[model samples]
Target: MASDYYITADNVFEYSRGNSLFDGLNEDQIKTLFSISREITLGKGSYLMHEGDPAREIFLIIEGELEISRYNAKHNQNHVIATLKAGDTVGEVALLDRGSRSASACAVSFCRLRSVSFDDLQDIADKDKSIYSIFYHMSRNIGERLRHSNDVALQAMEKQLDEFKTRVTLGNFFVYIVIMLSLFTFSLDGLKYIMTAGKNSSYITLPLTLAFFVFFIFFIKTSNFPLSTFGLTLANWKKAVREGIVFTIPFAAVIVAVKWVLISSVPHYMGRPLIEGLTAMNADPKTWWMFLVIYILVIAPLQELLSRGGLQGPLEEFLSSKYKVPLAILVSNLLFSTLHLFMSLEIGLLVFIPGVYFGWLYSRTHNLLGVWIAHALVGTVGLSIVGF
Candidate 1:
């Protein structure tokens, strides 16, 4: 087997430029170019450049494929911006403008690349007009390719969006079928069971909740999701927490006002009495302290571990290969919602919407912090009324 290694200057010079923008370079110029360059190898699944990071150097791919992606917030996915094969150069635009990189670059295989710092290349361009021409032409060509790639990506996104609409329609149709069949099979019995279950649910809730937490922890331990995928370390966690609190203050104020208004003005829309029962449970000092301990030490961390850490990580890897954002979101969201079935169908659906949103956020940002914060916030607010 060929030893996969990093890009180096010697191999970079030997590599044929073919019809690339750099193809105009003669052998002598290519050799001269090698003088200022150094080779570096990247293992499969390694990053070359991250979006929004300073573009300090230009990369010439000597082997394997390089994937370029831009984060799409609306879709909550990483959109493929372009792909580069051997002899392709990346970050030329960033080099010219001294701007942050617009896309992230990752090595798809064990690959080699030749890198030249922007400062060094600028010096060469200043002294050698020919080199400057090469740089200008390469930059322009790359820009044109990027624009074309963007157009193609947009078309693909539109197509995918249409497909997503179709899938959602199909999914809803299936759900209706299931609901109808269930109603036909056990109408009165099912209604009675639901009513009885709701009345007696408190006895089972604690055990079910504990089971869910345990399973969540196990899922996290067994999964391969990278904890720091979004550059979220302990330091980032603290920062995110601070930001989360800031965001929640305004959001909570609005929610509280809306809830108060609805409760006071609308008889039919009166809020559920569930919160009152929870509030009473929480008002007991001993119960409140225990609830706090369970949540802070157990529930919050475990759920984050399972949902964001475990589920989202493997889900990203699996979906990345297929490149089907909607399907990935649906599957992951379904799983998230299914785990909450013991709660209530209404609660499950409520959690599902955010589950899909969080999955998308994870795919786009490649970070777990946002979803973790959202999950924790939901639990804290919803559970706080009960006492935790």
Candidate 2:
């Protein structure tokens, strides 16, 4: 719903004084314009107007943000072309051309605006010649928008040309592999503890993992790849988590089935329950709940960042093969599995199977949320609950 208010002459000037749309207007002209203008407040997510609708009024934004977008009927999507902020004027194109709106506008946040109808503007023009200045300013604003659009298009083309010129080569892939292997050396300290029985690896592994994570961040920043390339952003988090859950359910069921087969067919096989495994690793079973929480929140996300985001993302970019995605996933998991060899050959092989799935999921979404969720759940269920 929208609220209407009567804006005083003083309030009107305060709002319109520095606005480009009202430039060169005198005190008397501004006052006359506001006299016929309506002050309206729109809540967030409210549509100001739809594309193809008759545009009879031009609005000056005093506060808040609005998205100007075009709807594609074929795609069933709205592509936001621009975000209008305070001091921006909207719907001026309709006033100039006497046509419908070219784009739809929806308030991004609570908005306060003053709108003047075309009919009222014509009446003002008949009474006073000075009103033509407002139209002139509106035309200038349209020209500025056109120039900005051209500049943005030119920048996009330049970026594509640059990418084509410096396309990643096999040498680039080898360089990246070398860097990752160099970083993997730091984890050997934790591996020694895992290999030695009765020596809890958590104290050693935790700090080592944190150090590796810090170095990973440094490498990513220096390499000039945006964090999004590694799926560290909050974009589409809900969708990412939803896809992760969808992937995880069937994967978890498969793990359970594998556990069932092992228990039923294997002679004298003793399944390692999560509690017993924690105890065997010298972790306090009393704090088992806390460990599960940390595994889900911290441990899972950290490993995903290293394996999928850090390794696989760049591998995909560097590989020119038609099957680059699968190759990247395979190569990344090879390194991922190799790191666990210090623990045990069996453990290393087991880790590769899930690492492949995680890498594939990361490739599809390119967001951490989904892969992180899947990794956390699979790890918890396989090692802790289902007992691999």
Candidate 3:
């Protein structure tokens, strides 16, 4: 297309009458604008503006079509924003902010446009009394474009978020199945413990259980789960202490109640793990202190880290896929309760309350330190009450 595709002065009156920025200007003002504005032509497939170029001019499309597009590194491409036509205004934002161009525009067909540089606009605003009113008009157009751009960006963001959720759901599903398999194995082993009554299997199975816990963490990590996923973090230690103390108060009450009921109601012929485990404490005072220390430190952290942190966190996430928060909590609660199956159904049922409560605390806090401390304190208190 030739440079004179549109004559600058020929349509000055017509453009000023209807064009947004120049509208409402008198004939003298229109003539003055026409004197300074340039007429430019772009051949098909030629760029009119580029992103990051210095903002200098605004354009009034006189004839033919152009397309607006933006580059996104994430998609590794330019996404088309709009297809503009004649009488449509472009580049008004340049006249206002005079910053870098946000998007690129290219002519789709041979095009003619009236262009007014910022310097020309500034000169007109300085000389003419009426030119000051164009700012609001330019701002309104920029706001519209911003809103449109935001809508496009928002749609893209929503799509990305949905994809991320799908990935997380698939991950949780795999982790959930593995944990269930591990629990099933543990339940079977508990039966073996009950049958043999710890006579010959102490050295082999106990060490194996410890090894299983280590492998369980490795297994979870291999699935891309972090320890922090189970709310295990030393970050926000003060908040953890407060939550631990708060959780422990009710926890202590529940522990005392459970222990009281167990002692008063259950008979003493028990050869269950807790009883048998605590019986070893009676060997001597040194052994008793050592057992208490180990219980408070090693056993308590490991158990809560397993059931509440590791098991409950992923299990709840798994159940929450198709269920509500209540059902998710309930399912995890049941799974935690089953850990005591070797003791009795009654004991399993009894522990379920604390399991649910502890899981709830972990969910609310998202830090295991609180629940770990509460679990340790409650376990120690409960064992002491049982004279273990």
Best by TM-score: 2
Better of 1 and 2 by lDDT: 2
For candidate 2, the lDDT comes to: 0.79
What is the lDDT for 174 in model 3? 62
**Residue 384 CA error for candidate 3 (Å)?**
4.5
Residue-by-residue lDDT tens digits, candidate 3, 1-388: 4334444466668656767766677877778877887878899999999988888888878888989998988979988988888877788766676778888999999888888888878887988768877777778777887898899889989978866765675575566557655866766765566546644222332443465467457646554455676666776767877988886887687655555566666776244343334453344566666666766676667767766666666665545365545565677678667655655686577668767777777777667787778776766665543442
TM-score, prediction 1: 0.42
- TM-score of every candidate relative to the true structure: 0.42, 0.53, 0.52
Q: Residue 148 of candidate 1: its Cα lDDT? A: 92
Residue range 1-388, candidate 1, lDDT tens digits = 1355543455544564564555667666666677788877888889998889988898877777889998888988886768888878888888777899989999888777888898887787687667776666787787689689879978998978866754554454345335433543444454347546554333343444455455444433443333463224454555555555565555545445555666677785466453453463435766666765676556655555555554555444445466665675676578667655655686677668656655655555444565566556655554465211
Off by over 4 Å in 1: 1-19, 73-77, 167-388
Q: How close is candidate 2 to the true structure, as a TM-score?
A: 0.53
- Top candidate when judged by lDDT against the true structure: 2
Q: What are the lDDT scores of the predictions, listed in order?
A: 0.62, 0.79, 0.69
Which tens-of-lDDT digit does each residue in 1-388 have in candidate 2? 3335445897777667777777778777888898998977889999999999998999988778899988989989987778999889999999999999999999999998888899999999988987898889989989998897788668868987757634543344456557666766865765585657555444444565676687677667556456786778888888888989998999999988877777677764446442335653345776666767777888888888888887888777667899999998998899878877777797888889989888877777788889999998898787667655
lDDT: worst 10-residue window of model 2? 272-281
Clash-forming residue pairs, model 2: none
* Deviation of model 1 at 243, angstroms: 63
